[model samples]
Target: MTRPSDHDHAPAPAALSADGGRADPAAPPGAPPGHPRRWAGLAVLSASLLLIVMDITILNVALPALSADLRPDSVQLLWIVDVYSLVVSGLLVTVAALGDRFGRRLMLVAGFAVFGVASAAVLLADGPGDVIAVRALLGVGGAMIMPSTLSMIRHLFTDPRERATALGVWAATAAVGSAIGPIVGGALLEHFSWQSAFLVNVPVMVVAIAAGLWLLPESRAARPGRWDAVGTVLSIAGMVALVYAIKHFGKEGFDDPGALVAALVAAVALPAFVVWCLRIPHPILEIRLFRRRAFSAGAVAALCTSLAVAAVLLLLAQWMQLVEGYGPLEAGVRLLPAAVGAVIASPAAPALAARIGARAVLSGGLVVSAAGYLVIAFGPRPLSYATVAVALLLVGAGMGSLAIASAVIMVGAPPEKSGSAAAVDETSYELGAALGVAVLGSVAAAAYRGDLPASWLAERGVTGATAAEARESIGNAMEIAAHAGTAGAELAARAQAAFTTSLEGASLAGGVLLLVAGVLVWVLAPRDLDVSGSSHH
Candidate 1:
């Protein structure tokens, strides 16, 4: 982390209202000054964000290839899949604060360097252990990049409308990246090798780093303080414990003793950190930001929407590949309707919000999302790809609206807190995505297990096997059962049926959650319908 420059000194709380909300417009404190290369700077920032967000889903299509190549145990496979997000979520707040205290531009360049190096490491990784280590490094690099981009944008675009337009572009990148990752990964997996996925980031980051160095201006917290080392440790520990407990519950059930202990640790650590913050002259995480109604509502909405969307995307990919037997390329192509719709909706969100109001946009989006889930839950049995496509289109549209609502949260806040605000929003987004995958993945797995046959062992002609053996060889059991004649065929069909039934139930639950979210958004978001030019990319 870069050291705080001499610019920081004693200042009053940044013009926040008693409720911790910004009562004044988010204008720059001085006359609007132009940067020689602001547009190039914004582009570099956008590229950085696109690379990090896109990576979130890039590995989805590579899971089978990865498993075959790495030959990891189940536990290793889980970590290989989740450790990037786990580490990223744990470190976001601490890293974001570090950037604010030091310099956003310096952090951006350093982060890009780290990401490029880490990507190279992952591509060259010889085994699962190496890949996991590289992924953790990528997470650290991502932690630095995310907040810097938002803070730079906060500093770059001083006008509210201009800022909203910039943020709209930023939000569009996220939707586009999410939409494109699997397709890109699939193409790479088919024509080249899995290593190509990591290699691709090299060029993107290189361009971004060069442009950032030439164009981005230095910006930092107006009244920086000493790096809060103790606060950083407490925050990471609390987040890791909390997320680990949640992840453990999804995997081993809520009753697992280890998960219970993790949950307890999280409970104690999080509050203790907050109390510690109150005592510190300069805290790493400004927990007081939550007092802002718009900020608070926006953060919660971002988390909820992300959680719902991540779960849906994961399950949908499984439905297409495992259940429907679609090839990687074919499945990725089928996802285009949703991706295209989201991209189209994303750019139009600012104008739409201007017409209907932010609260209405959010509430309406949630309603559309809930309806999409209902369509999935009640769609014809044996599944129709067309039905799935249409449902995703609706879900994508809804997500576009929520993205705009979130843009408002930052646009309306004081500029000094922009990094912190963006940090909070981004944190919710990543954490929500992680929880979504974990909770939904676990539910889906349990459903798959429940749907499996008691006759599986008998069909294989095995009375018993060691726990590790059974877990590792579940796929072999299915293959064996399929070849064992009429009994095996019946067992296989029953298992498939059970899994599909579980998917239907999960979709229905998702619909209910989206509906509840819609109601909350309607009740909680601000009534003002106008767009301010205060937010940035």
Candidate 2:
């Protein structure tokens, strides 16, 4: 669905080797091969990635205040949070295709402008509807910005070794942004207002826009063929339905009929989209990449790890804020260990892979992640911060494995196909985040209800509807506790205890999943897989 353009500001194509295959796009005519400015371009792309990741986590701490200020009902509140992700996840493939057809830098620059405007528009938002609309706008911008980051990296660092290193740094920055989201949000909320979270993006996006203009070069797919309009529509429909299905399952659990119907829709639409992609000459996603065992193994590894950690990180924030009675800032600061682990491990992933091989490194990382989950699950009562910190360290450190996974994904494809490859990688990540929150979060929520002591509530003289309310969520129990007398205090205590038990059970379940994925990666990822060699005929 791209409109052909006469604008020809795009950078000249890099020269190919005599083999007539894809060559290093880093080199332009009359300029030495692999220009040093490419590194600076990498910096710009990484900055964009950091900003988006931070924005996602930053909202978590601001949601309550936003709700209070806007006075949104439950459905509106959900939309305020859910709409952005739905929009981003649904349109990623389409936008990435646009980037390929038109220009990567063009799409990226437009995204920055759009993101900056949407974020600043929040300053004028006086109601839930306004905020939701702005959030949806930001999602379109985010969808455009995200895929360009990886694909640009793929183009900028044509040397396999340099690309691997760049990817590692990019991965670390991404993890850091996610870990620091609460801290940034808490810091802003403490000094400013809820709108500050959205406003903060304005300045960052401004800087990104300026830097991108100077540093980034325009690139596009050399043979981006006819736009698959029907495929694009199907992808959007399927992904949106899929995200909704996951959200519904997370909120209402498996018994909800709405979730069931949404799942049915997703089941039909997604597979149809996949079949369409396979039959087409030009697809938004290169599903054929999964035919490579190394690529498939790495993809599965990334998805599994993301599924486990996404939920744990989410619940950990709440555990710190509500259960442990820490302020948002303190909770965010305490979570720094996870960032530290990522910083250490991500940069080391390439070296580890070089030494031990992709299969071993990927599998080892998964095993370490599973251990971290187990540690958190089995931690002592009162949820010791020290124990959780260690688990966070392990979790973050283990994500270094994704560096290798990412390399496999990118290297498996030729330079011309990087956009589709990047889209596929991002899609796996988005799906992982969705599934993690949906399935693992649902397990924790179910366990929370199961562990809620109905008998204990009765003994405290809080039964029936009140008891059910207490079991609904920690926030509800806290609201009840604030208004109720001594019985309310007892109810809140029981509810917190139940949530803790539930979290532990969920962590145990995630740990088992990682362990199984680790085994699969070990078996399926070829031991001799090398990123540098994948592009050669």
Candidate 3:
């Protein structure tokens, strides 16, 4: 079987400009002059990306306040957090395919409208169920927005090098959004209600909807074949079931029959979905792209980086607030080292890759991140903020390589398959986050429990339900400590110590995972891979 060169996958003749105009005929072959408003349009897309990424972390900061107001049980609280990702991950391939069939611009605009409406609807949410519904709607909106940004970038920047730069900016925006989410949420919670966090998205989204329509061009697959309805269903069912199974396993381990059933569904449906895609002419996703070493390497880099960072970041946020006794805003500020490192490194990654090689940058970044995690696991002393800050900086700097990963994935694919490529890239991120939290979070939780055994709690006069609660989480233990007098102080100290120990254990595990992924990617990625050119060979 002869493989097609990247040149064979160039933008279709029908692709449009940023102003929804015809492509420039006078432009050079394989490197057309992009839309006049391309740079400005990138700003609009970056803003949208910022909000989408920020929403996840903002909820983390707002959870305590929301919990106080809604008084949701553990199950409901879990639903409120997990449902958004569930909906987003399940719908990504379907929505991205729709964008390619319809118009990327239309999908983006609609996503903005949906996001704004959902954010505003938070005002009416008076219960946990209402908030959960609102989150699901936001997930729908997020699903629409994420891939469109990447696909649109592929359209707007015809030059592979220029597109790489744009992707670097896009990656930076995502890093900033995640880094600042807690700060924004903390500020909102300080001045207003937990509802304010959701409400804040309304105005920005309204503006984004207006700007996106004006700035973004309408582009779609010039010859998108008939929709693969079966493929869509299988993809959705497989992803939803897979994510659900992971979440359930994390929460309940292998003892839960429901998790096992969900895992079974995912196992069957996913492989079947892959076969269905291969058999179809116009599959919902471009499954064949994985044949390219660069594309596969990029996907692996994104997944492993997200997996190594996500759960640790979430745990650190709690560590700052609960163990170190920092306020939300202060903790958010302290967390800035990671963001700062990313901001500095993201834009520089492409340039760095040019001097070295894409393979080195991508694999080296993961190696750096693994070092950061190892630092956290083996750093000096009783775990101070200074030690954590250094570790965060290293980790964030390492994440900058994702820009290279994105470029490799997008540039490696034909423009006609941009939507599919983007969907795959985003899916890696979403799945990685889900897996990180589930797998690494379980590790941390088990370690925490192991350190604070029920027997120890019982010996400390925290018998029955209180003892169980203490072992449940550091947060619950601290809450009990707030009112338990002398015993309370002892419990708080022990719980904090246990949490710190668990964080170390989880970090060590995550570090090992990252090291292994780095080695794999290093072996897989081509030594001479050039992200600026559309050639794998």
Best by lDDT: 3
RMSD to truth, every model? 6.6, 6.1, 5.1
Residues 1-537, model 1: lDDT tens digits: 000010111011111112211222544467375455666677777777777866766666666556556665544554665677667777887777778778889998989999999988875798989988888898889888877777777687655434444554566667677778888877877887767778888888888888888889998878766778887788788777876676667656779998899899889888999998878766776677676555566666677777777767766764666557676666666777767766766656656776777778767877887788788889877767778888888888777666555555564455666555656667777777666656665565556555564455455453444222223323333344446566666554555565566667667777788888788767766677333423221
| Candidate 2 Cα deviation (angstroms), residue 533 | 2.7
Angstrom error of the Cα, residue 99, model 1: value is 1.9
Off by over 4 Å in 2: 1-40, 63-86, 121-135, 154-168, 249-255, 414-416, 453-470, 534-537
Q: Write down the RMSD of candidate 3 (Cα, Å).
A: 5.1
lDDT of 1: 0.66
Which regions of candidate 3 fall more than 4 Å away from where they truly are? 1-37, 67-80, 124-130, 156-168, 411-418
| Ranked candidates, highest lDDT first | 3, 2, 1
Evaluation by lDDT, superior candidate among 1 and 2:
2
lDDT of 3: 0.78
